[model samples]
Target: MWPLPVRPERSYSGEIRNFSKLFGTERNRFGSLHKLTLYYLPIAIFVAVYVLIILRNLRWFRIPVWTIMMAGAVAMIFSGAIPLGDAYASINLNVIFFLLGMFSVVAGMDLSGLLEYLTLKLLRVAKSPQKAFGLVLIGISMMSAFLVNDTLALMATPIMLSVAKQLRIRPGVFLITLALGVTIGSTMTAIGNPQNLLIALSTGIPNPMLDFLYYLAPPTLAGLGVTYLILRWYYRKEFANSTLAQLQVNPREAIKDRKLAKLSGWAAGIVVLGFFLVGIAELFGIQGNFNLGTISLLGATIVFLGSGRRREILRSVDWGIILFFISLFIVMQAFWESNALQSLMIYLPVLNRSDPGLSLVTIILASAFFSQLLSNVPFVAVYIKAMQAAGFTGADVKAWMALAGASTLAGGISLLGAASNVIVLEEAESRGSGFGFVEFSKIGLLVTIPNLLILYLFLRVL
Candidate 1:
C-alpha cells in the first residue's frame, strides 16, 4: 500500500524484522557452538595463542587482555590439567553470586548516599589533610578487607578525585594512595579478590575466610604500619607542605539524601550480616548449606525490591567484567586440557615439593617479582595450581599468605606493576599533573624492600 518512494524504507524494515527473527531462532545454535568451542578447541588454540603472545611478543596487538585470559582458561578446560574444573565451577558460581549480592548491597548504599556521608563525616572529624588522608586510607582498607577490591577502587577513586579537585591539590597523590590502600586491604580477607577466591576454592582448608583473617590480620596491619612509616620517611617534606587546607567538609552538602542514606545503610548492614551468618553456618558445620551464589542473588533481589531502584543497581553492575570472567573460565578449562600446565610445572624446578618451605618462599618471591613484570592477577592465576601441587602445609599456607601480601602490596613498586597505578597515572595525565614512573618508584621502593623483608621473616622464621 506504500508509495514507490517509501517502498525502500518499508522493505528495509521488513528485512530487519526477518533478520531479527532468524537471529533469535538461531541464537541457541550459536550458544551451543560457543560451548563446543570452549570445550573442544580450547587446548589447541590456547597453546598456539599463548606461544604467540609470550614467544612472539604479540601483546602489543590490539587484542584485549581479557581475550587472552579467556584463551588461557579455555586451554585449561581442554587439557583437564586442573582436574578440578567441576569443583571450580561450583566455586565460581558461588563467587559470582556473592559478588552479585555484595554489589547490590553496595549499590543500594551508594544510591542512599552513605559513602558520601561517611567521607564528609570523616573529613570533618580529622584535624588536618594528613590525618584525613590516613583516616580515609584506613577506612577504605578495612572495608576492602571484606569487600571486592575492584569495587572499592572503582567507588573510592571518583570520590577521591572529587575531593582532590576541591582541595586544589594534585589528585595524583590522593588517587594513587587510595588505590594502593585498597589493593593492600583486599588481601586481608578471603573474599576480597579473585586470587583469594581461587585459593579458597581449590584448597581443603576449613573456614577459609576465618582462617585467612587469623593469619593475615597481624601481617596486613604490620604492612600498613610499615607503609605509613616508609611514606613518612620518603615523603616527609611533601607531607609537611601538602595540607588540605582548602578542602571543606559539609555532611549535608556531601550527602544528597540523608533518609535514603539511613535506609541503604540499614539494608547494607543486613546483607553483610547475612554474609557473616553464612560464614558462621559453614564454620559450625550446619547441615543445610546455602549456596553463596544463591545467597548473593537473593540479597541483590531483596535490595532491588526494597529500594525500588532495580534499574540503577543493575546499571552499576559490571557485565563486561562478568563476561570477561566467564570467558576466562572457558580458557582456563582449555589450558588444563592441553597438558601445557603440567609441562610448565615440570620445568619450574622451584616446585620440587621436596623442600616445601623453600618452595613456598620461592613461590612468594617469584610471584612478587613476576607481578612487578606482568600482573598480580594473572600471575596468581597461573601459579595457583602449581603452588598447590607443590604440597604446602600449614607453614606453607602462612608463606603463601605472605607471598600474596607481597605480590599485591608490591603493586606500588612501579607504575606498571599495578592496574591501580596506571589508572592513577591516567588521571594525572588528564589533570596535567606530572607523575612519572621514576618518581613513583622512588616512593614505592622505600616501602617495598622493608615489607619484603618483614614478609620473609614472617614466613621463614616466625
Candidate 2:
C-alpha cells in the first residue's frame, strides 16, 4: 500500500491565497465574455437590421424597422452589454420630438388638402413636358428644404404623374426627378430630413439653421441645378419636339376644404418663420440653450389640434419611425460603450487629424459611400458616434454640414439608397409604371456623381 501523504497545516494565509486565485480566474472569464457580448452581439444585430433594409423584397411582408431596432436593443439589454440607464439615456429625445412634429405637421397639411391644392397649382403652370420637368424640380427642391423629403415625395409623386399623363410622356423620369430632387434638396437645411436633424442635434451648433443656410445652401442649389440639367439631357429623347402644354389639373377642384387648406398653409409658414426666429434668438444668446425641436413640436401640436382631421392625421403619424429611433439609440449606445469602434479607428489615423477642411471632406466621403449601403439615417447615427470615438470635434460646424450634404445627396445615387426614394418608388408603382433598379441606378449615378464632385470642390474652395 502506498504511504499516506502528510496533510498541510491549516493556515489562514494559504486559505486566503487559494481564494484569491479562484476569484481572479472567475473575474477574468467574466470580463472576457462581457467584452465579447458587448461588441459582437450589438454588431450582429446592427448588421441584421441593415441587411433587412438593403433587401427590398423583405419589405413585402411589412416588417417594420422598429421591430428590428427593438430586437437589437432587447438583445443588448438581455446580454448585459449595456446598463439600462445608459441605454435609455442614449436616445436623443430632441431628435425624436423633431421627427414627430414633422410627421404630424406633414400629415395635417396633406389631410387638409393644402398640399394637393398647392401641388396642382404648380402643375398647372408646367406648359410642356420639358417645362413640367423643370417646374417639378424647382417645386420639389424648395419644398424639401423645409418639408421632410419623404412627405413631399408622397404628396408630389401623384401630382407629377398627373402632369406626365397629360403630356403623354412616360411618368418614370418625372417620378425619378422628384426622388432625386428631394434627396438633393434635403441637404439644404437642418430641418430638411431626419439625418440632418440628428446631425444638428449631435453637434449642438449655436445656429444650426444659419450654418446650413450659409455653408450648405449654395452647394445644395448648385447640385439641384446640375441635377436638373442632367435629368433634362437624359430625358431629352422623351421631350423631343414637344411644346409647352397647359396642365390639365384644376387647382380649385383639388382643394377639398378651403378654410382648412388655408389654415394649414399658414401653419407651415408660421413653423418656418419660427425656425428662423428661434435660430436667430439662440444665435444672439437670447435663449442660447433653446431646442428647435420644441418649436417644431409646438407647431405640430397646433396644426394637429386645429386642422379638424385629428383622427386621420394622428393615425397616419409615423409612430413606428419614432420607436425605431429610440431603439437605434439604445443599440448604438451599447456599441459606443464597447470601445471596439475606437480600437478600429487606430487603423485610420489620418481621419482623426485636426484639419477641419480635410477632416470634413473625409467624413463626407465616408458618410456618402456608406450611406448608399446602409441608408443615410442609420448611417448618420452610427457614423456620428464613430466620429466622436475618433476624437472628432464639433468646434467646426463645416464638417457636420458637409456630412449632411454628402449623405443626403448620396441617396440620389441608387434607388435603394434612401428611405424617401423608396417611398417615392412605391408610390409611383401604385399610380402607374415605375423604373427598374438598373435603369434608376444608371441615371441616378450619372447625376449624383457630378453633384458630389461639385460639392467636394465647393467645400474645398469655400
Candidate 3:
C-alpha cells in the first residue's frame, strides 16, 4: 500500500471539530451539520453537474458540459472537500498531453484533407446502401482502433451526412452507425479512447496495446459484425430499396495539400509504429520507460515542424475537452477523498477477488450501469482508485482488462454514456441534422447488450 501523506493539526476536519468545541451547548447539532456538509456536498455537486450535462441542450438553459464540470470542481475546492494542492495533483498530465498531441496530429490530417481522401476512397467502393453501411461500420471501426474514437467521430460526422444525402437515405441511421462503430472499435486498444488510456496508464499494464489486442480484439470484431447485422435488420426498410448514386468524385482530388498530407501521414504512421514497437518490446521481457503520451507528443512535434499550419492545428485542438478533463480530475479526486464513494461501495456487489468469473461479471455490470450516470471517463477514473484500494494490483491483468472493456462498451448504453456520442451529436446538430436522445438510446440499448455479452464471453474463455 502507498503511504498516506502526513497531515498537520490544522487540517480542515480538525478545524471543524475545534470550532464545535466552542459552542458546547449546540456543538452536537452544529457538528452534525458540518460533517454532513463536508462529506455529502461533493456527491451532491457531482450529481447536479451530471444532471445539467444531460440537460445541457435544453432550449432555455443552454450550457457547455465543460463549464458544468468546472463549476463542480470549483465548488469542491471552496467547500473544502479536498485541499487545493491535492486537487492540482489529481489532474493526470499524461492523459492531457496525450490528448493534446493526438488532437493536433488529427487536426493536421483533417486540414490537409488526407483523412477525407482516405475515407472517401474506402467508401467509394460501395455500389449499394448495404455495402456502404457495412463499409462505414467496418472501416470507421478499424480506423478508430488506432486514431481514437472521439477524433474519428469528429472527422466522420460530415462525411456520413454527405453519404446519407448521396444515397437518398436518412442520415440518422448512418450517424448512429458511426457512433456505434467508434465505440466498439475503440475497445481494442489502450489509446483508442480516454477511459482505456486511463486503465492502461494507471494499472501498470506491461504491454497494454498487445494485451488489449489479445483479449479484446476478438470480441470487438465480433461486436462489430453483430452490430452490422442488428442495424441491417432494424433498418431493413431503409436498406431494402436504396442504391448508391454515381458519386462523380475522385479521392485523389480531395487532398488540399499533397505536401502537408504526406507529412501528416508520416507523423501518424510513426506514432502507431512506436506504440506497437514499445508493446512488442515489453512482451519480449525487455523493460523500457516508453509510454503512449511520449510517442504521441513526438508525432505532434513532427507535424508542427513539418507542416506550416501550426497555429490552425493548435486552434483545432479541443480546448474545452482539455478543460473538462482537468476539472473532472479535481472533482473526482475530491469525491473519492470524501469517503462517500467508499461508503456507497459497501452496498454494491462485492468483487470476488478469488473468483475471476464472478468478479468479471460484477465489474462489467457495475461499470456499464455507473458509466451511464457518470460517463465512462469519469467513472473509470474513480473506479481505478477503488480497484486499487480493494487490493487489485498491476498483475491482475484480466481484472483491469475487464474494467476497460465494460466501461468502454457502457458508452453504447445511452446518448450521454460517452463523450464521443456527445461529439457526434453536437457536430450533427451544427449541420442541422442530428439524432434524438430517444432515437440514439433505442439503438444504443440494442447494440450494447450483445456487444457486452460478446465482451464477457471473450474475456472469460480467452
Q: Which candidate has the highest TM-score of all? A: 2
Q: What are the per-residue Cα lDDT tens digits for candidate 2 across 170-253?
A: 788778888888888888899898889888888766688888888888888888888888889888998885545545678788
TM-score of 1: 0.78
**Which whole-number lDDT from 0 to 100 does residue 317 have in model 3?**
85
Candidate 3 lDDT by residue in tens digits, 160-199: 8888887777889989889988999999999899899888
Give candidate 1's error at residue 78 in angstroms: 11
- Each model's lDDT comes to 0.65, 0.78, 0.86
Candidate 2 lands at a TM-score of 0.91
Q: Please, what is the TM-score per model?
A: 0.78, 0.91, 0.88
Tens-place lDDT per residue, model 1, 21-41, is: 999879978977665554445
Ranking by lDDT: 3, 2, 1
Clashing pairs in 2: 127-244, 127-245, 128-245
Listed per candidate, the RMSD to the true structure in angstroms reads 14.6, 3.8, 9.7
Ranking by TM-score: 2, 3, 1
RMSD of 2: 3.8
